[model samples]
Target: MNSFLSNAKRSCGEFLSSFKISQSTILHMVLGNNSCDLDSCVSAIVLAWFRSQMKNGNEVYVPVVNIERKQFRTRTEIAYLLDHLNIDSRNIICIDEANVRELSNVGKGFFHLTLVDHHVLLKSIEYLQTYVKEIIDHRPQLIELPSRIKCNISLVGSCSTLVAEEMLKNKAFSVPSVVETLLLATILIDTSNLSVDVGKSTPRDEAVVKQLSGKRTKDELNLLFRSVADAKFSVSGLTTEEIILKDPKWIENSLETIMMSTLHLDVREFFAREDSIDVIRNYCATHNLLAWVALAPVINQFKPIALYCEDDEVREKIIEKLIVSDLLLVKTSDEDHARSDVKFLRMYNCKNTRKQVLPLINEVLQQRSSNLSA
Candidate 1:
């Protein structure tokens, strides 16, 4: 086992063990988002380490949020990265491993949490609502918790960049070389190696890398990114359901449950697979998923494609409004395959990522609901 990983495992075990000793103790859990993407996972681990070092005697553990030990296999890139650093998945503690309800039973002020990667808490994990202590995220701030907590929300390529900055500024313990590599890989992949065309990255991202890798060149970062990306985009053994589930963000509205899936693979190739469509439909049916929104990176030149499931009247109405409201949504060329709820359309404005498109879809759904109520 790697020294860093062994140390991490020992710390996590000690943290969990401390929580069991008493109901009067304050146990701080640094948790990532449900997506469990590269950025979220990295931010949780690195920030938790930094915080634990600062806390001196507090109980702090970083738990991989919303994912089980076995489910780590679904996140191929995460697995590959951990494996590269000689970190064993078994050493890490998953969300399911700890009894959340048991934490709630431990009494007030006994359990505290610090969120990384996401500002808002999922409905499923609302049990931890009163326990939130701090939040560090890169996305726009959504909700403000009542407690006096440190909130670091910035517009960076990756949340990990913000975490790295904190570590550097605090003059925290010297970051290991392997840990530096881990942080750099996340930023490179998330920002597409700081490509301006993607527009997700900023100068801070590059500056951070330069600081972390004083003598290293851009080529080395690119090489590391390619290695990680190759692992991320590999879908040889993953079924279509697994592909959809990987890096999925779930949204629960008053009406229904929706899953927004983001993929790094070629959209055209995914659409061509009939089995893929079946898998999505079957999974949706089994899980009672009201809708599924699929977005992929630009593939086939400037042709960007977006897919959505509109099997019923409500979903169809949402889709209709989405097309009408979205200037980027080019409905001129769309194909609804027979017997499949999924439909694919070419996005003329490739810049509107899932982040931009999601709001439009939600707006449409909201408007439709208002009309029905009126």
Candidate 2:
């Protein structure tokens, strides 16, 4: 009855007629990072958009992380839309921890398969590429791939926002109030509330959030902020080594001595609990280190405040000064600020920092060698 819903119906009819996909065709809805709000929002938008375009008896499959992981929250949104349209639930397939190899083999006979994701896991992308007729992502790598795989990359704030914008353009699904709220939450979480240090907010995300939560209360913003802050670091059952390797960039540099530098206490708990700094120092003391850097990215007024230290003493001295300078500071007995320091090295993609720091570390190694010779 509303303009948005009417437009959604019209768009779905047009797309179904255009694609010529029959009611018997199976539609696979693959999602990544079920724990992430952005992923959940994107999955809902894509499923709703597709449902609008199809008729009865078509199948929709959703791949979840685990049955108990609560990835199926998107199902509620999907149900809302489907119920409005009088669609049946029997046609939807919700698979959890699915074996990709097995699913591909099973879907081989199906006429149409579509995959949507924002996560940049290479292995998952390759697997989906094998059978997925269409793929949507914001990762630059997906855009670089060959043309046969239908890939759309907009580099927006959140992949869910991107999909919603696309649907809005095509007049596909009704942009429901809840869908809009989810999109706004995803953008805020992903962009660190549009802090410049994390990178500027994507225009698309900004526009959608503005359109959805017009004149949001301060309490609402605070609640959203808390939700994201709580999810930023997960340390349960994780070793110091495991935490370091969580980022893919760090995994690639596992063989080399990577320099991690952070403002002293940010990762003090992690380094101390895992005993990683000692491990790193011992390893660097023995092996040939290819890279090393200490980068302290201080958040001052929502911008990156960088302080570079090439030597351990220099870093310690600076941190002491910082503590004395009225900045709320905590010192670590573990002395593994280097681990958090190096973690950011991979995060900001600063290869040049490694080039600068390694030489200084090597100098320290050589100075110790000269002292031993004396």
Q: What is the lDDT of residue 182 in candidate 1?
A: 80
- lDDT by residue (1-374, candidate 2, tens digit) is 13333443333334334435544545454544322233443454454444545446655444332122232332333334344344443333233333444445444554344545543333323455556556666544422555666767666656666666665664544555555555555667656676555564677776766665667875786576556445434334444443433221110121223333322224434445556665445444554443333333333322112233345664554345433432222332223244444322222232222223333344444444566567
Per-model C-alpha RMSD: 2.9, 12.1
lDDT on C-alpha atoms for all candidate structures: 0.72, 0.44
Per-model tally of clashing residue pairs:
0, 8
Model 2, which residues run further than 4 Å from truth? 1-25, 33-57, 61-96, 107-113, 118-121, 124-127, 170-173, 196-198, 234-265, 275-374
lDDT of 1 by residue, 248-279 (tens): 88766555667788875777677677787778
TM-score winner: 1
Error of 1 at 134 (Å): 0.7
Worst 10 residues of 1 by lDDT: 332-341
